[model samples]
Target: MKRIPMEIKVLIAIFLAGVISVLWYVYDTKAKRRAEAAAPTPISQPIDP
Candidate 1:
């Protein structure tokens, strides 16, 4: 059996991290949209110091 090189392993790890980040971002965005849609409307008010 041939062993894998360290550089290739590092590259694979980085690639996996990028893929995971993209998936998480998509899931988070969808969840945020759903939450926003389900939220109640807020009363109109102006911010005051």
Candidate 2:
């Protein structure tokens, strides 16, 4: 069995983290859009001075 170098391990970790973050951002945006679409619009009331 061979041991991997620290630099390669660090690079792999960074790459994986970047990929995960991108995926999370895409999913979060889609979820937010869906939630916004399902939510009802609020009616504004006239304020008397």
C-alpha TM-score for every candidate: 0.79, 0.77
- Deviation (Å) of 8 in candidate 2: 0.4
What value does the lDDT take at residue 7 in candidate 2? 100
Off by over 4 Å in 2: 42-49
Instruction: List model 1 lDDT by residue over 1-49, tens digit each.
Output: 8999999999999999999999999999888778767867422344468
Task: List where candidate 1 sits over 4 angstroms from the true fold.
Answer: 42-49
Model 2 lDDT per residue over 1-49, tens place: 8999999999999999999999999999888778767867522345469
The count of residue-pair clashes in candidate 2 stands at 0
Task: Report RMSD (Å) for each prediction in the order shown.
Answer: 4.0, 5.6
